[model samples]
Target: MTSVKEQEATRRLMVFLQEWDSAHKVARSHILDNFIKSNDSKTEPELELEFSQGASLFLARLAAWLRMTYTYSTCLRKLLRSIGIFLSAASGHRYLIEFLEIGDVLILLEILGLNYHKEEDKRESVKLLQLIADAGRKYKELICESYGVQSLAKFLATSNSAEAQEDTQILLDSLGHSNPKYQNQVYKGLIAVLPCASPRAQQLALQTLRVMQDVVGEAPTAVVEPVLGVLRSTHLQVQHEAIQLLKVLMAHQVRPALLEGLVAFLTPSCRKELTFCSETAADTATLGLKEPKLVYTQQAAAAKIVGVLAKESAEVAEELIQMKVVHGLMVAVGNLDHVASQRYASISLEYFVHMFPFLEECVKNALGDTLFQHFMDSPETWYTKMDPLQAEELASIVIDIP
Candidate 1:
């Protein structure tokens, strides 16, 4: 370890480099800039010469200081950000990569771990991870094997910070870019984090999975299963996020067993919401006052699932048509808050009108002509400006009737 006095001297030296404007010595500054701008491949030698010319001692001292300072030190962190700006430098890139290999990553990982205890430190940890990920992409094999991966995975597993989770996704993305060899490592980390991850993390993980699936041609069934399991997750957001990912897996043409399991894992309300059984089919309307919030979420999730299913399963679409979802929505339009309730009821209307051609018969049977006349008669009740879309959809429905 460097002595405290030496450390202070190095700290002062780093400060000196920061304030040492090359304009103070224009000749040297021009020489340095020219060397960097040189397109000649042979300029590498001259570039090194220029970089070494006056700042050589300063650069050497700075690199030593960086290597000496604890990774937790504020000065060292600021220096890393400074180094990050010059990472495009051929020599600078090589030097930073070398530094990463020689314990820089371990230190960074330690900092990332600190994110759990210190909210303020989380951003620094994310920045460090971003730098590692940006540079590590070029050195995939090393990065996959680096301390950064384990640290990142561990942080991803536990850190609640949205930024940390997003950074972890980026880090995994970089790993995916590096080599196919790290694909399983990335998948493993995601799976490990899935059950405990925050809603945002879960969403980002699904996004990462989608990109990885494209990159790797097809992800392993093992990978797909864990994400499929997220549908059964207790978090409503996780359930919502899983919908699209599950669609991807299904579209990828998953194994029948996996598909069956995925279908089974679909929450009961989600399944009910999507299938839209006959409104007259006591089973559909009998859905009593279950949690009102859940009722709304179930309706939204169902509508999305129904839309996706309409593209694939005509039977499911036919079932949705029979369920009189339009009537149910029109009814819902009157029950709750104007803004949120109306928004979903309007969406349900859009899906209803667009997806089901036999919408009139379904609506008539579900809401008998008497009730239909009442609803139509109460035009003013439906006239709430909160749901202009509902009005538009209703008008379209009325116009389509022969």
Candidate 2:
């Protein structure tokens, strides 16, 4: 079965593999340089055909070399570069499948787990993994089955490089689309990175979660709890993103815990407590007190979530009413300093009145006539920019209350 042509090809491949495994850095470089140069002029088909003969053996040797090389060794980098070159040469689904069949794909994933000191190496590892996953759905499924999603998540959570995280996220997203089975794992991975000190990681995690929300469905309280904590993030964009995710999650299923969390933000006393704590901490900073504060945007977001929840059903509205949310809404709407919060608060109030007409008395008592007059008299000047019908509806609620 061993023809002379096959014998010569295996011998040449072994020579190249031996050169790659040499202890001298120059020998490894010579092999990589020659390999890249030789492949430069070859088309994918040509490269595929040339390598198809001894591809499995070549990859097996490469994997063994990779396992033996120290993560930070120049030899490891050269080996990775050589693999990348080979992958570039074999750029087709067919070759990708061939590589997968021989366990090279798994080898690439294992390389990713190594604690490489260089960010470039990390990025390159993730890039190669991404290339394999992009080859086809079957490749993606294989990656997921091998715990690729979990590995990427761990990498994402710990990686300091934005480029590396982005690459990993792309792979995870691809796996997510290729198979629904990995949704929960993907979700957990994204959530695990949410609390990372790196803002970019947190943002990428949020963005990925937003895209994966439909597939993720109702996340566990542990997952959702961190997202809620992200609401307090100093970054405005992060806060907005968290709010958007919470809205989507709430829309899918009304969680009482989420409702309770949103309602807490609507409380004026709670906001004041935050402010008071902040001021007191500033005064006592010399004594090591920490400042705690909630931005108006957060309050606005909470009110918006409330409006969305109330619009879902009368029972939800009644739930908020029972929580005494009307008092908070009244305070928010009458606070002219924050127009956005006022607007959302007004929307929530409208939902309350429309859902449970009896709550009108509670709202009326909370606002009193003078402030209610201010609410009605200068509708044009209201920063919320309420339309005439909306303004009228709000006015009708207060006016017809008797």
- Using lDDT as the measure, the top candidate is 2
What is the clash tally of candidate 2?
A: 0
Against the correct fold, how does model 1 do in TM-score?
0.54
Which residues of candidate 1, in runs, are more than 4 Å off? 1-74, 82-91, 115-138, 147-150, 153-167, 191-199, 219-247, 254-299, 308-402
Q: Provide the overall lDDT of each model, using Cα atoms, as 2-decimal numbers.
A: 0.51, 0.64
lDDT of 1 by residue, 1-402 (tens): 978976766666555555553323344344334433452232223434534333344434444555665444444444444444343344555545545555555555566666334544555545655655666445555656765566676776566677767767787777876577777777667665554435566667777776676666665666554564444333566666666666566545453434443232223333443322222211221334344443444444443454465567555545544454444455445434333444545454455555665564656554446644544455334325334454434422422232
Per-residue lDDT value at 301 in model 2: 64
Worst 10 residues of 2 by lDDT: 276-285
Please give the RMSD of candidate 1 to the true structure: 11.6
Tens digits of per-residue lDDT, candidate 2, 71-145, equal: 546756556666665565544445455555667666666666777547667677777787777777776777888
Residue 114, model 1: lDDT of: 61
